[model samples]
Each structure stands twice: as C-alpha cells, then as structure tokens.
Target: MTTSTPAGHARVAADAPHGPAGGRTALVFSGQGNQWLGMGRDLMAREPSVRAVLETADDVLLGATGWSLLGELAASEGESQLADPAVLQPTLVALQIALAGLLAERGLVADHFVGHSLGEIAAAAAAGALDLPEALHLARLRGELMRKAVGTGRTALLGVDAERAEALIAVYGGGADVAAWNAPEATLVAGDAGTVEAVVAELTGREVFARTLPGDIAFHSRFLEPLRTEFTEAARGLLVPRPTSGRVVSTVTGTLLEGGTDSDYWAANLREPVRFVQAVDTLLELGCRTFVEIGPHPTLGPSLTDCCAHRGVTPLVLPTLRRGEGEQENVLRTLWELRRTGAVRAAAPAGGHRVRFLTAVTAETPPPALRGRQAQFAARAAAKALTALGAAVPGDGAATATVTWDSTDDLAPEAASVVAAPVAPGADTAAVYARTPGTDWLRLATARPGTGTVPTLPDPAELTARCTARRYVADTAVASAAQDADDVLVRLRPGTGTGRRAHLELAVRITAAVLGAHAPIELCDVTGYDDTVAGDRVHVARMADGTARTTVLDAAGRPLLHIARSAWRTRHTAADPVTAPAPAAAGTTEAAALDLDALRAADPATRLTLLTDWVREAAAAMLRTGVDRVPALKPLNRLGVDSVIGLELRRRVAAVFGAEISVVRLLRGATPADLAADLDDWLTDTPDAGPGTAPVCSAPGAVGPGPDLDDPADIERLLDDLDALSPEEVDSLLGRLADDAASEI
Candidate 1:
C-alpha cells in the first residue's frame, strides 16, 4: 500500500482488501540466502504450533540425515551447519511452513500460495498438493542431491536490470547466466568461479556495484545438471501427487500449476532459472492484492514490490520475521497491520465473555445528585457504575478497585452523569466516565476484578539497601524510601492519620520529586481506600503513557490504596528561590582556608572524603534538602537538579573552592562521589595556580571595575570589589578611608 501525508497526518491507502470477505490474500514463501543464526527461536519458544512443526521436522530429518534440525538452528555461528545446503534448505522450508501455520491460527488464511526456488515445495504442501511428510522428504532429497553435485560455480548479485546483466555476461564471453530477476535495478548471475570473479572485477572497474553471494553453490544454474538424473530418479520413487485444496502458483513455469507434479517437473525445477517476477505477475492477474512473506527474513519482499509496482499497483506486502530483530514483536506488528487494514478479523473466544457497551444517559434520564467530598462521592459513583453495568462490586477484605480520573477539575456535589463501557471486546474490565449533567462523556475511571488475596510485599530492608547502593536520596517525610529505575517506594511517616486526600498528595509529591517534574499533578487512577490503613507504603511505577500508577500497600502486603494513573499537567510554576551565601572577604585567613591547596596537601583518601562531603553539602544547598539526604553517588539529575540549578552549583563551587567546573560536566549524570573523585584527580595532576585565588563578588547587580568609583557605572564595580574583600580587608579599608576623611576635615 502507498503511504501519503495530508494535512500533516499519515494516511495509508488501503487499495487491496478491506477484510477476509474482500479481495483474495496470498502467502509468499521465501527461498534461501535469508537464514541467520538464532532465526525462528523466539517463535519456537512462544508458539506451540511452531514448536510442534520444528520438533516434527527434527524427528523427520534425524532418521534421514542423522543430524538434528533443532540442534543446527540453536548452534552458535562457528558451530552452526546452517551454511550447509543439506541443512539450510530443509530448515528454511520447515520455518516457512511453521510460519504459515501460525498465520492461519491467527485468522489470516491464504487463498493462494507461491514460492521462489526451493520454497515451491513448502507452498505445494501448504496448498494440500502433497502431505507434509512427502514434501519434507522431497526437501531432504533435493538438499542432499544439490550438496553432492560436482560443480565449481559461484553466484553474485548486480545492481542492473536482467537485460544489462545478460549483455555483460555476453560481453565478458563467459559461461555465466542470469539466475533470477530480483528488482527493476537488481539481478542475480551465476557461473563457474573464475568466470564469475572476472565478470565482477570488470563491473567494479566500471564503477557498478556488485556483491558476490556467499558459498560456492550456484543455485538455479546449469551447474546442478550432474544431479538432475539422480534427483529425478529419487523423486520418481517418492512421487504420489493429488489435486491441491488451494491454488499453487509455480515459479518454474511462471503460472498456476494446472495439475500434480511429476519427477520430470521436479528435475526441471532444479535446473531452471527462477521466474520470480513472472510468478508475481500471475498472482496479480488472479486478483491477490495482499502478500505475506513466510520466512525467517524478508528475502523476497523487494522483488515482490518491484514486480507489483511495474503493473501500477502498490499491493500490501508484509514479512513474518526479519533478521537481527525480535521475532515475536515483528510477527505481532504484522498481525496488527493485517487486522488494522481489515485483512483479518479479530476473533473472540467461543464463550460469551465480551462485556457490552453501556449506553450514554439521555436528557430524560437525569443522573443522581452527588453528595459528600470528591473521595467519598467517587467511591459511591464507582459502585453505582458497576451495578448499572451488571458487574459485581468488589467485596470488602483484601479486594481493591482502581479509579481513574480523566480531568483533575474538582467535581461539585451536584447532579452528575456516569457512563461505562468495556475496555475491549471479550475483556472483563470496564471503563467508566463521569461528567456534569448534559455534557459530553470523558473517561474518568476503570475497574477490574480484584485479586481475592493480598500479594507478598517486597523486603523493605532489601529495597532500602538497593536505593543506598544506587545513591538515591531518601525522602525524610517517608519513614523509609527506596527507588529502582522509575519505580519508587516510600513508607508513610508513622502516626500520620489515614486521610485519603492527604496520602494522595504525599504520593504525588514523592513521584514528582523522583521524576524532576514541577507541573501540577493530574489524578488518573486511584484504588483501594475502602479500608484505609495507617502507615501504608506507597509504590509508584512510571507508565509508558507518561503517567504513574501509585499503589498503597499495608504492612501485610495487602493493597490498602491505589492510584491507577497520575500525570503532570505540563504547566510549570516558578521554582522556589534559592538562598545565597553571604559574601566572603578575599585575601583573608577564612578565604585561604577554603583554597584547593589545603585539599591538595591532604592524603588521597582524606582528600576524596573531604571533596565528596563538600559536593554533598553544596548539592544539598542547591536542592534545598538536608545534607544527609543528598546521595553521594546518585546522579545530580536524579536528585532533582536541572541545568539552571547545575549552573548555580558550578558558580558556587568556583566561588568556594577556587575551581572552575563546567555546568555540562556537573549535569552529565555524574554523582557527587564521581565529581569528588574527578576533582581529586585534577588537584593531584595540576600545580598550585594563583588565578582562582580571589573570592567571587557576591553583591547583587555587581559589574567589573570602571575608570572612577564616583561614576554611577564605577559605583557598582567598587561595590563588587568591596563585596569580594575579606572581613579583615574591609575593616582595614574602612579605617584608612576614615583617616583620610579626618585629614581632609
């Protein structure tokens, strides 16, 4: 399908089928040169159908080749026999067949099937022309015969059309022949090794790009003629053909297979060039507009697209898997695309588990008036919604209910409407929305069946130790706190009364601190407050939708309260003002005491400890937190320090320690301990420099020196210099100025 953008929104043209009832769909089986190590392993582990097919193939091949198909696929690169033709060919066929079975299970049934080169055997078996065993036997025999063929041929792909490739072969006067036409500008040629090498060298001289395929076997070339007789004889003994249940397009003859194949047909398939483009044209003529390539990787997609494009059609082409990517994710993406394009129908299970959508309340049916505060009203509203939707209410005890609010606007204790619907087809969960009477409905909450019992709580000490190891600052308000990645767990301060609103506000603040967010919190979901327990632990997990889910658990691990979803409103207020230190006088004992020379003269261990302590104290001052709470090894950003604050900290370091450090370095995920170590290293390597000896000027709006202190511009400069002077320096200067004034008097 073609993708276009109109009005800044992507639009995919569904020119093919709208659903299974619409246009026909075809399954395109891929051939060789696409296999990789660890291919199809994910599928084998996740899909029972795939695993069954692979295990069956392994059993089948063991008796025939005395080697395990599963073992070969699991082998590391160096130990793998996947490069062997005898192993790779059958392995590819088995994988393709397994993928087809998987698609069929997922409600995507093929109306027709096609294969390129060795893939034809799998296509035939899938179309019911041959039994699986017969097809697998043919694959084994074919691989064995091809591997035993006596030939010294090689193959290479060229960035040229089939016609130019033929011309080059003719001009070179070699025995090379075109093996396959891949795309409008891509072609494959095969010949004896020396001739193919010379042809590639000649193309390189012309600045034409060409790449030689790995291995020495020239498939779909005349080099396999020696095995033709033996393959035909072996196939004749195993031949037992029947009418296919589905259509099978042939790449050998480039048309639909009219009848069952014979030994001679199999022999011709072995020694003939792959007419992939022509077969694609036949599929297009037969009204198939959606093609799903079944293989470990997409080796035929480019060719299929090129062929379809030549006919002025942009057919929907999808691959079952790709190399160097997660196979399960790729397969799911393909399935999702197919369903989105209406090529497959999402099927529900046999039983009627689907929840019905609740109709919106009409003007005639006025809602009940709300009573009490938001928290109390919300609980009653949720119970009413569950009853209206014919759902069972969560029982008291360890049961919990999740409530999500779409808007943070305070709901008045007046008339309000509650509408509910199922989250998805065949889902047990229901989403409920609440709004003022006579207004549009927006989702406000969702409730699912709760667990009958409580879940075990994680060890608080273990979590605390992990937090300390990661150098995360703990919230003092929280009795004990810990963090793992984006998840934060904090115990409520003991003796705090169990107030729902108060607990929610505390949880939101903790989440905001860890996220480094300054915006107001929007409540998305809250759960389990029917039996509010004092001293509950709040656990907040960051969600993929930029929201956090906060759950409050009691000491016994039962969920006492839960906020299913909460998010920042994206509008930020001005930060709290930072308290600046009083100006220190320059050239005084106090200023000299803060110099780096003293730190440098100390032993390495003591120096590191001193610097680390200094860093912690400075960071704490900047963050407006307790010095004990500042983590020595935690990243500055994780400790809620941003760029502006980092710059201020950098200036403070220069002023206090007489060292200049960049703001970028302070904010690049470096911890207080790391910065201390770096400073220690710098002090050790650098000699005593007097450039940073002067204390920084701290007067507000102060500038540098000017021509005269009497001038308005120079007055600010004089004030700045005075601010930089030590207490003793200031006293001495004041005495001298007083004496001069007395003499003038």
Candidate 2:
C-alpha cells in the first residue's frame, strides 16, 4: 500500500495505519470564501441536468459579488459578477446542491457534513442547515463583516512543517498568542506585522520563506469581532432548518458543532486550532473508510489524499480528476462513487444441504468406492446442471467454491484410518471427519470441502471460514440445518424432482425461515434443478398409494425414507453424475403463493402501513424541487416530521431514500396556501439573495398602513372609487399605482 508522497516532505507518521481504536473519521466542506473560478465547472459539465442548478445559482448570484467567478452569470445584468461574499455563499450553496444532486443520481452521499469558516454555511446548506438563498446571504455577510473587522491585518506564516511552523511562530512573536495548525505541513499565524516580521527575521532559513500573504486579515482569529457582531445581526433575520444529517463537524477541531449556537462556530472557529487531522481521524474511527472532498480548486485535495495515503485509507476526491477536464468527468465520478456507496444490491441468499462426509471410513481399506473419475464426473455434472437450474452465484457470477470428499464414516461407523481425502489444513468441519463418508477428490487436497452444499457459500473456502451458519453464510450449512430441524415444516409438490434449483430455493426459504425466526414466510423460486446423486440411501420408488413415494429400503428391502435420518445428504457415482432434484416430499405440500393484492386485503392497519410505504417510495423516486413538489410537502409535514427525522425515516423505511429528493417539497407546507407561498418564496428568493431583497413575497397581504387606516368611511370611499372605475381600467391602473406608491415610500 506504499504510495508516492510529495518529495522533500517528511512522513507525517511512519506507523499511520496502526490506529488505536480501530480507525478514524471526519466531515469536511468548502466554505464560500474558498470558491474560485472553474469551481463546479467539472461537475456541471458531466451532468447536463446539473447545469440547470448552476443556472439557478447564476440567477441567485452574479453581479452581486463584484468579482470574477470563473464563468459569467446567465443574467441580463451582464456587468454583475457573483464573487460577492453574500452572493458567493449562495453560489457555493447552489454548487453543493448540484454536487449532491449529481451524487444522488448515481447513489453516493456522506456519513457526516463538515465545514470550514465560510464553508460551514455550505455545510449547513448541504445538511439542510439553511435554504439555498439564506446560506448565500449569511456567507456573504460573514465575508464582508470579517473583511471589515480585520481591516487589512496580516497573517504571517512561519513554515509548512508542523514543528518548524510552530517553532517559527513562537520564535517570531507568540507569547500570549495562539498556534493553529491546519495540516502536518501548513499553519496559519495571525498577529501584528512588526512582531510577525521580527519573529520571521529571528527564524530565518529554518523553513520556507515567511511568504507574508497580503489578505492575511487574521482569518479565524479574534481580530474579526466587528465581523462576528455584524454577522450575528444578519443571522437573526434568517431561519435555519435542522441538519438533515447527524453531525456537523466543526473545522475548528474536527468536533461536533453546538446546535443553535454560533459563538463556538464563529469565535473559536476563527481563533482556534484547525484540527483537520484529528477530524479526519475521528471519521475514520467512526467507520468511514473512504474520503471524498467535493469541488473547486481542490486545495484540500492534496492534504486529504496525503493524509489518507499516509494513514492507509482510501481517498475519493472529486474535481481533480474532473476540474480542468470539465463537468462531465466530475459528474460521472460523482455518480459512480455515489453508486458505490449509496445503492443496495438486493441478493437472494444461497442454499445447500449438508452431507456429512464420514471421515473415518476410507475407500482405501474396505467399502467398494466409486473411482476418482466417477466421483469427479458425477459431482461436476450435477453442479453444472444445478447452475443451469438457476443457482445464483455471488453477484460476481463466480461462486465461493469449497472442496471436500465424501466419506463412508458418516454413512456407517468405522475406524479412524486414512480416508479418501485428507482434511484440508483449515478444515472448518475438521472435527466432523469422524462422521463423514470418505471418497477420492481432485488436486484440491488443500481444500476442505464443507459437509454438504451450502447455498450461502461465497466460494468453497467459506465453510471452513465460519463457525456458526447464521453468523456465517453458506447456502449448504443453513440448508443442512433446515433439513435437520425437528419440524417436518412443509411438503414439496409431487412429480417435482428435488433438483439443484429446488435445493437453492429451499435454502433461501429455510435460511429466511430459520434466521428470520420463521416470520410469516414467503418463498418462490421457479427455476428447475438437477444434481448428481443427492442421497446415499433414499430413492423415489413406487408405493401402495400409487404416488411416487420416496423409500430407502436396501437390497434387504427395508424402507430408507422411513428410516430415521434427520438430513438427506447427497452421494455420487459415474452413472448418477447428473442427479435430478430430489423427488418432491412424500406428503402435504404448500397450497399457494402470497401476492401483494391478497396481502393488502389481509387487515386494515396492515393495508394502510403497506400503502403508506408504497406512497413514500413513490415520492422518493420522483424527486422534485421548487414549485412542482410543493404539493407533496404537506402530508410529510402533517406527519410531524423534521428534516433529520425525515431522513432517518426514509433510510429506515423507504427503499429509494438514496434518491435525495428536495426537503422543500417534502416539508414546509402544512396546507396548500403554505405550499404555494413556499413556491413563491422559492421563485423570488433566487434573485434577492442580498441585503435588501430578502424576506420575499412581503408576506403577502401584510397591512402596510395598519389595516386600511381603520376607518369605515375610508373603506367605503375606496369601494366607491372602485365602483366608479371600470373593472378593466381599475385592474390595469392598480399595478402602476402600487409601483408608484412603493417608489414614493
């Protein structure tokens, strides 16, 4: 797993992969300030649908920033740029949405959301912390006030090496000062220029030059008091929603952000340690093995990838791979990654019966045994036939093959002498050798075959890999358990041979029944099955009832089917290489299969529950945004749902919650009026994401003059005027008059 690292850089830690508590984890997001030109260009180009989102962002931003934003805005006011902090925050918001939308389309999402300075706003937007427009305005205000507060302050950097960086900062000036390490190789030093310069002069040539970046402004330092105050005032007029995810990691320390409190996120975030390493570590500890940094310059990309490679973890950063190449690459990568993480591959588990290979009895000493050629052909042919009968291999189409030899020991007791096939080194059923019948096997002398065919087995290696069937998955083991269970359970259809397909279906049913603890059972597998000899004793011989009764009588003519063996194990011979499925069980078979309509007709409560699930699933698939989905929000809201709860419910209940539908359309409208108002806000909020334009729709019908002057006569006079005017003229003139009145005010 050794990966190339940037040269001249010391290994952060030699033993990175050796984490104490198993691993680490972190949530990361780019704030508004970090956005640059070509930010989402890569993602936008990939998914043409996502371009609409970018267009929406341009509609919300542009011309407001008064700076360059990679691409021009699609607005009539061509002069305006969206680089303004206020507008940029929204731009970042839109970018994150478009990114999330693209990811969802392919099925990728995150375990948590984390944000840096302005990035916190985008993070909030990502987790539904605030709507798109509000997030933009907040980020813009933060940037503006922060710039105002700092007032051209300088952040003198000492060096990129953590030790050198810290030593340089300390030697440079820090006495009562702070030391914030951004990464192993980067640190941000904030203070007065004279002292900073003095310290730099003190520690000359120990590291890279004191670069003395211009816009230092002591970002994330206490110098932004005025900015914090202004930002707070602005935040009050806004309404932020609950985060759609569980935790929002604070970039300050890679810890959880305190909800409803911006003091910690604001003050400490600016002035505190940027413990990104610790945050990443925490995420890895939380069971997140993959790291995905979304969009833009990818400044964080190198740091993140280096960290993961150093720590022996996987890093899936977007836009690197995509940025210059354009949106197409970005979108495709996002979709593919999302698909890797987001979608569930439904599997119909495996099934196989246990044939205890009697280890003690060997063909070498006594019992006339089938030749090696005979055993191989019988087994191979039977396996091929079962595969043809619809036996599902793993999704990979390659089965987990396990090899073992049949012994005569389980069939009849004998001394523990050399058997046909010696136990493989790691035989799971090694102890059971005493009970198995022995037979010759191929070059698989190193492989310990399982007792019987396990439908759940991945490859043959799995049987020895697990101790318990439920804890492990072997189609053969569980099916064996079902076959050996005390209950007769149910019967198989007459004239139907118990073939490979039948055993596989039975394995699925049996595993589901036993592991699921026999919850109302539902089983269906219509594929036909064929196998080599499936039983050592029993045969589908005729009976007095004129039915194909299974009997186990030997040459002595004693009934073998009625003989008391719990599970029927398979046997092999050259002639019986292609064994048919066992004949259907002798007696009572299943009456019929259950269908949705019949289940729906079962009980009222059950029916509602089922129908409700169906409706929710439908809603998930047809993800809607803006006005189109407004009507769908009320029912969700009336259910008393919150965003986090809604997300959780969808994950737990809905099959397609991974679709990532709009929270706006799925909530916020308790009534049609509320929904319509929500839609109007969505439409208008697009343009007015700045200081004066917000609080859209003016809360329609809000009495501007305090209830029409509260004069009955004034109302009467207005009515009289309306009556005197022609209806068309009154309507036509009304709009103009209102505009004039507002302009005058």
Candidate 3:
C-alpha cells in the first residue's frame, strides 16, 4: 500500500515478511495527550514486572529532569496536565516503552511495529531499533524544546475528511497548517493560537465539531522550525543508529524505516504530518493480521478499525489498556482470543476424560498491603471461586452455589484465584462459539467485619445465588486478543464478589491468576472504581500452559477485566514477590554527645577546626568519598549528590552534632568549609547555655555574635517569634534591630 501527501515525502511498499511463522502481531503505540492520573496504578500493584517499569521511568526522569513522573501520575487528578509537550512527550514515550516490555513478557510478540507521533520513539526502542535510554533522552529533549515554542497550539476537527480539512485550512487557517491526517473523518490543524481558534470557530459554525487539544504549541507544523537547529544538536548525542531488527512502519514518511532510526530521521519526524491512516494500511500490506495498541488508553483503536475498513481488510485490532477497564483481565482476554483462533496453541491437551483443575492456593495469607485494602475482599472472593473449581466433578450436574468471603474472616484471602473449568470429559461437544448470556452472572456481596466479632459461615444454599441469564461482554478481539475457533471457552465466577468502593484494588489480585506463569507477566489497562457494581460473568479460556485469558464484566456487559499472559505453570514459586524496603534510622555517635560547654570555652580558631573536621567526616561518609577527596569549594551536585542524597547529608550533620540544618541551606552553602565556619561561630557564642555552662548574653538590643542565622531551627524559631508580634510591633522591632546593626558596622 502506498499514499503520499502534497509534500511527496515518501512511498511505502508491502515488502516486509507478513506475520511471523506462529502468527503475526503488530504493536501500535499511542503518543501524547492520552495520559491520565490513574493509568497504570492497578497494573503496577498486580504485576511487579510492570511496577519495575514504572520505577525505572521514575528514576530516569527524576534524574534527568528533577521532576517525578510517578509522583505526577499519582498526584494529579484524572485531568492531569501531562499534555504539556515537555511533560507528555517524555511521559508518553516512557509509558509506551514500558508497556511494550510488559506485553513482551506475556508472550505477545510484535512482528511489525509503528508509532503515532512521539510514539514512534517507543516503537523504535521496542523493536531494538533504538536503545531505551537513547529514546528517553531524545524524547525529553523533544518535549523540552517543543515546550519552549509558545503562543501556538493544536486543534482537531471531527467529521471532516482530509481534503475538506485542507480546504477549510486554506479558507480560515490564516497561516495555520494541517498537522495530521488522523483518520477518514478526523483531522488536526496547528498554528498560532488565534488562527487555530478561528479555524475551530469556522468549523464549528459549519457544525464540524472542532476542539482544541491540550498543548501550548503547534506541533507537526512549520511554527516549530525555529527550534530545529538547536533540537537537532541536542538530539544528536541522545540517539544512536537504528539496529536491523523488527520492521517499523514510519507514520512520518508513510514508508518503512529502511536505514533504521537516526538523529536526522527523528528531526524531520518532529515536523511531519502523521499519515496514520496510510501507516496502518502499510502495516496491513506487510501481513500483520493482529494490531495491538500499547499505551495508557485506547485512543487509536477506532482509527485502526477505520483504517482496516478503508483498505477492505479485516485485521484484528486490540488495545493493551482501556480508560476504565481491568488492565490484567483485558490482556489475558486478548491471549484467549489468539488461542481460540489457533493463532496460538495451548501447551496441554484435554481428552482423557480427566479435567485438569487449575487454581491458586487460598490457604496462604495475603500480603500486608492487601490487608484491609479494597483488594482484600477480592482475595476472599477469588478463594471462594477456587474452592468451587477444586470441588468440580467431571460430568456432574450443574453446580450452583454462591461463595462469600465475609469480611469477619481472620484468614486473609489469596491475591488471585486461577481456576480452570474445561469441557465435560466424554460429553458431546462441537467447535462452536457460545456467547455467555448476561443474566447468567453470579451475585456476590460483602459486609464489613463487625468489631471483635467472629461470624459463622453461611449455609451453602443461603450463600449462593444466581442471576437471570444475560449476555456476555462482547469481545473486542477478546478486547485485547483476537477471537478464535477450536478454543474451549468457559465461564468462571471467581471475580463476581463485591465490596466497599476501594476493593477495586482487588482488580490486581483477581487478574493475577491469568498472569501466573513461569515467565514474568506485565499488566496493562486497569479499571477505576465507579459507583456501579460489576455483576457480569467472568469469561475464561486457556491460552497456553495453565494460563487462561479471562474477562470480568460490569453490569452493562462491558469488559471490566484484562490481564497479560505468561507461560502457564501448574506449580507455584514466588521467585520475585513484592515486598516493602526497610526504613532508615538515625544513629547518634559519641561525638554527637560531646559537651556544648567544651566547644563554647574553646577559642574561635580551635572551634572552627573541630567543626570543619566533623563536617568533612559527615560529607565523606554520606558521599562515600575520602575526607580529602571531597571538594571543599564545588557544588554538591558536581559530586553526584542529588536531592535525595543531599537530604541525607543534612540528617548526618544533625545526628553527629545536634545541629539541625535545612537541605536547601546545606546545598546552597558556598562550601563545606564556609558552612562549618558559620556553625563554629554559633557554637562558640552560644546564646542559651547547656546544663553545665552559663549563658552568653549581650545587651538587650544588640546583634547576636557572628553569622549564627545558618541554623534552620533557630531561623524557624526567630520567624515564629516575629510572627507572634502585631504588624506594627514587627515593624518597630525590625527598625530597632536594623539601626543597632548599622551603628555596630
């Protein structure tokens, strides 16, 4: 497939090998403007592997930009300002790259890869075309440079074809440029803010439903040309030559990246229109039967579908994460679709009139973090479901029962329950698709444990309740995986329990069963708690090993679950269990307990020498450098003392000398020697005496001896005393103190 804009950038030929031998899957990445505050939180909790990605990203960004990516994600509301080009560009790249690693852990391979806008950087990194650090550095540089371009912005016009969009720009753009050819009916325009707004007004007047995007600068437009030279120079050190691995369909040029990724290619990519429609078709021509959108949400799923339709192809489009879906469940469901379609085969067979039961051991205790958290109740619910799975007898009549995990139970529930219910052995069954009815969902509910009360278990008949049959959540390529034939689809109600709103934490544990494989699993697409209770049936289908691609649903029959799949294992081994780190403690040395009176009696020079030696020792110990090796006149950052370690230095000084200092002051002091001199002077002229010494006092309105204001605690106390006075009193005191100091000078 080939397409070109008026600029005649390039052409794409379907020359790459279609899908790999097993099955072809293309990993598609979403760019900026798709981040939300709670995006990958649940996934991080459920899968330590995903948590590692989040940690790495946080560390890298924190080191490079002095901003906490994780803190921003955790602190912001749903409508976070991650859209700032500076924040979003780097964040989006990190998110997509991390998600790609997570997906790879689930046995989902990308035969062909493509990215939209900044997403291309992540794709290159995922495909071995670029290293992660290099990609991250470039992304950070791109975002920072783009953020510098102010007064311009981007706007999108819906229901407008590319031709109509271009014509509208010519008519009302007033110097605006078409930024992207997003879809058959969606186009983005960028330029000066006023011009873009004017275009939006003109389009809205014509009932085109236009809106501005969340950015302050015009991207993919000529407005950014002024920054090209500087950006190219900075990007040169950040990007390496692309490798010869996974093929990446370039949305910038609408062709394959033949020479691999490079500084020049990325430089041009920054100002090029995203020919997304053409790029999708190009991947289709390359024989990628399955398309997976990897990111925080499903912004590109619809566009991918439309692109396939435009080309008269029926490609399987999947999303790794959704706005409000269970991340682990959705991923597992995708794997199920692949297995059902024979795109993937199961590791075991079932035919000997024997049903191999799969379940998590509920007898073990849940982790402390899970205790009393929202996911706690979910653990019990999964335990109940596992009990049912273990009790199932082949060819037995329908087993109808409700399993309730009363909050009063002292036993903590397991994180997840992976229970498999295969077809009845020796029963007549055909290779036919049976959509689970909605009314067939099981009803589970929770009650808070009463204070100091032990509750008796409810009767099985009284506890279990079945709802009227209903429709199963319609599959979206299993939502994340494509549907298949010759697959055994069964419904397991392990996830039907309900609890307090916070129990959505249970989403991670409930999804853990599907991720219980020898290889680590990565979770994507986690759901947030809404008021509505999810009463939909949980669908399960074995993909490979003991792994089952499962989906839990809301009352509305929407997929509420998604999980990644790893090689299934019948036995369990916690090779990597999540645990909290030990807390740090401050210790006092004999030097710290030395008498203040001794220091006060010493001469100024002697005191200064002692304080300088102590300061040097503290700095050396904290920085792991020799006392002499530590620079006395250089900034702490020069010795790699980041903010985290700077604070530690402050603590060390306080512990050793009973002298409190602020991290800000310690870091900003001219040098260690200068700071020590100030501290020594304060100690020698102690205002308030220790138990064995007399107080050193001057006249009532006199200046305190030598620069003693370096003590943060003393400064704080001074500020507090000043605050207690009336405004007039404060002014009068300040005037008197200033006059006394001036007279002394």
lDDT of each: 0.63, 0.39, 0.53
Clash number by candidate, in order: 8, 83, 33
Please tell me which predicted candidate would have the highest lDDT against the true structure: 1
lDDT of 3 by residue, 1-745 (tens): 1224423222322453322223367889888766766777666655555777778878888899888777766665654657567777877787788777766654454678899998998988888888767877888888887767776666555567777666766777457777777877777778777777777888789887788876577878888777777777777766667664548888887667786666767877787778887777667666666777888888987788776666555556667776655565555445544433434333222232211111111112111122223234443343333233332112212122222221221221223222322125532211111112232222332211112221121122211232223212221111121112312222333334453221222333333332322212222112222324543333344443444333344544444333222122111222332221112234534443565677777777666666666666566555533354465666555665654555566445544454534443443443566657656655655546333332222212333223334455644565679646433333234434444555964
* Per-residue C-alpha lDDT of model 1 across residues 150-205, encoded as one tens digit per residue: 46588999888778888777777757887876666777889877767777888888
Candidate 1 local Cα displacement, residue 638, angstroms: 34
Q: Can you give the lDDT of residue 199 in candidate 3? A: 73
- Reference-based TM-score of each model: 0.47, 0.39, 0.48
lDDT of 2: 0.39
Decide which is better by TM-score, 1 or 2: 1
lDDT of 3 at 629: 48
Off by over 4 Å in 3: 1-23, 76-83, 244-246, 343-376, 380-745
